[model samples]
Target: MKVYILWHVHHVAVDEVGNVAHFENGEFSARENLGDDVKLLGVYSTPDRVERRISVARTLPGFRDEPDCFWSAEVEVDEDDWASGYVTE
Candidate 1:
């Protein structure tokens, strides 16, 4: 099953066009610049549900200021993610 993970980040977020400052090989994409004030708002089963939640959240305080900060990513359930062990430097 696909789940929509909602996230709210606090930062001077940049648009897609200016997100990457360099073009090494081909077009490279990155989200490493997003600041550390990340909030896991909620996870919904459907996109519609995610939309509904976002709409309401946008009307609320704090969130209203950064309405565009809201975003959702679809991920499958019961998936073996990060099977390879990670390292901490």
Candidate 2:
């Protein structure tokens, strides 16, 4: 079985001192033991951030984990004209 993992970073900043430029681009990886049944397809950030979402999937282990999954994908974003700040509502 094959699964897809989608991850994103919102706000792009953690604090007033932090900026979007400091945020890492993106990264993904997989973990599996030799002949291990349990498998994990993990997508994570190279540089940890305050806001991050990780989705996991179960699939057969592969020789290479860094496959290009974002090829020919379209993304849409909403623009409300807001500052990069912590919001709780």
Candidate of highest lDDT? 1
Span of ten consecutive residues with least summed lDDT in model 1: 20-29
Write down the TM-score of every candidate.
0.69, 0.19
Q: What is the TM-score of candidate 2? A: 0.19
lDDT of 1 by residue, 1-89 (tens): 89999987555445567552222245322345453356789999999999999899889888887676776789999988899989987
State model 2's lDDT: 0.28
Per-candidate count of clashing residue pairs (backbone under 3 Å)? 0, 0
Per-residue lDDT over 1-89 for candidate 2, one digit per residue giving the tens place of the 0 to 100 score: 22233432222233355533222345322212212122223433332221122212112133123223211112233433355777787
Q: By TM-score, who's the top model here?
A: 1
- Which ranges of candidate 2 are over 4 A from the true structure? 14-17, 21-89
Candidate 1 local Cα displacement, residue 54, angstroms: 0.7
